[model samples]
Target: MGELDTFTDALDYPVYVVTTAAGERMAGCLVGFASQCSMDPPRFMVWLSKANRTYRVARDASHLAVHTLRDDQRDTAELFGGRTGDEIDKFEHIGWRWPTAAGAATAPVLDDVSAWFLGRVEGRVDGGDHVGFLLSPVAESPAGPVRPPLLLLSDVVDLSPGHPA
Candidate 1:
């Protein structure tokens, strides 16, 4: 392995489930490559693989709902990460809903998650096989009284992704 690979090997980043919609189409996927990229302007970036169906929908999506996962939510992770959207309807298996507020975009918010936020897509950056979606937080779900420990990469290292990254 290279030096960069060795460096990243020691890190365990938090896992997130990002959901978005365009017209009648909606998609969500397990994401490990995302972070808060800006502080002053408050921007978050999520990297989606070009091969995933979510990427196709996100291309025309105006907003995305990013959900935080907990250690106990491994089953949810498996559903999103292990099954491809091309083969099945993931939403039918999970509890989710469209934003009810007036003039809200059709981003699907996941239920029973640790926390979540709605972000308007600001821009897109082509990063080889992955495209980074720059987001500015427009809304957020109310925080639960207690915050649980987050699910990490190390916890799902053995999972086979639904689609090749």
Candidate 2:
């Protein structure tokens, strides 16, 4: 372990809930390592920890849904971040609707999301402990009436990972 640092060190980045659909179900989790990696072609990248069950499922996924939480939706963050999908379906507790897209699987798009993007995996890179998935946004939507402030890392400090940390 390294020297102790302030909690703020870990609370710097914006968090997102990433979802993937495989067969008849969907899996999602709170993701801290994700960003727009390209501009001209418009690419986004998300790193998924190998230990997460969501990662295992996402490995086989063709499309991924990235959703930002509204500041009031801390519970949504807790549900996806703190609990493992191996035990329960997180979508069961959240209100969401499936959007239709050709050549891609469907994942639930939460009703209260601040914003969302559906991406097709273009490439993947192995980064030791985590895998980086490069995505091309095929579709996007902004929450119009529900344009609430986004939930950040600080708001989810108490949530424990469903998998081993």
Candidate 3:
């Protein structure tokens, strides 16, 4: 078990902020468990913790907006990942805009990012403590080499989770 922890910690991957809105509520959270699950149809998956406030909003959301932050953009990660949306509105402190009805439904799109993609929710999988939301790409902004370096777990390891494990 200790070795598994060590092995997993050794792998550095990009961290993402996933946002969703439903009814009159909006929520977003820092996400690390996400990946491309399909190629032909271009499907993506994002895992939201059961303890996160964003998960509640995403459960019935039609679409989700995922963003990749840069190394210099740790503040965005801290805002979304280190604080509880139940107590504060994450968008009020960040540079964000609501999506058009034809866009990503009520999802908030963060303008401060290296890249972003809007995905339509296809289905949900009950994966133990976390639920997996399958997404089909609706719109995407490709990142270039000139953009900031990808944010990683090591960058956010120092911060404490707003919602306890």
Candidate 4:
């Protein structure tokens, strides 16, 4: 083996919540393993840990909603990132609403988001610990009047998982 990098070191990137509108609302922890993969076609990719409950829901989701948190929205990040939706209804506590885009799924759009994008899952590929989802943006918008600083991995250091890994 070459070497093993600590997950902490490997995960030091902007965190986000990847959500889906299947039967029920679901969301999960996503480190910075996402990026704009295309320009002309307008595509983005997000990698969700296979071990995550959100991935299970997302696998069947028609649309995945991507939300960026404001620095003040760390609480929201912690709830989604550190906890599993398998045992809890995260939407109960978060302020959210459904998108108006045509053919939009039942995913929740965080009300306090800094920015958001609703993408259709164009493709999916297994990436070992995580599954990579290629999303083609169909709808997007800024969340609030004031742009907020994005919450990063460094901001949510104290939160621990509420579900068994």
Candidate 2: count the clashes. 0
Better of 2 and 4 by lDDT: 2
Q: Candidate 2: where are CA atoms >4 Å away?
A: 2-11, 101-104, 143-147
Instruction: By lDDT, rank the candidates, best first.
Output: 1, 3, 2, 4
Sorting all predicted structures by TM-score, with the top scorer first, yields 1, 3, 2, 4
Candidate 3 residue pairs that clash: none
lDDT of each: 0.91, 0.83, 0.88, 0.77
TM-score of 4: 0.85
Q: Using alpha carbons, what is the TM-score of model 1?
A: 0.95
Assess every candidate by TM-score.
0.95, 0.88, 0.92, 0.85
Model 4 misplacement above 4 A: 1-12, 28-30, 143-146, 163-165
Q: Taking the tens digit of each residue's C-alpha lDDT, what string does model 3 give over 9-102? A: 7888999999999998999999989999999989999999999999999987998999999899899999989999999999889888775534
How far does residue 133 in candidate 4 sit from its true spot (Å)? 0.5
* Candidate 3: C-alpha lDDT: 0.88
Per-residue lDDT for 78-129 in model 2, tens only? 8999999999988889888775653444566777688988888899999878
Q: Which pairs clash in model 2?
A: none
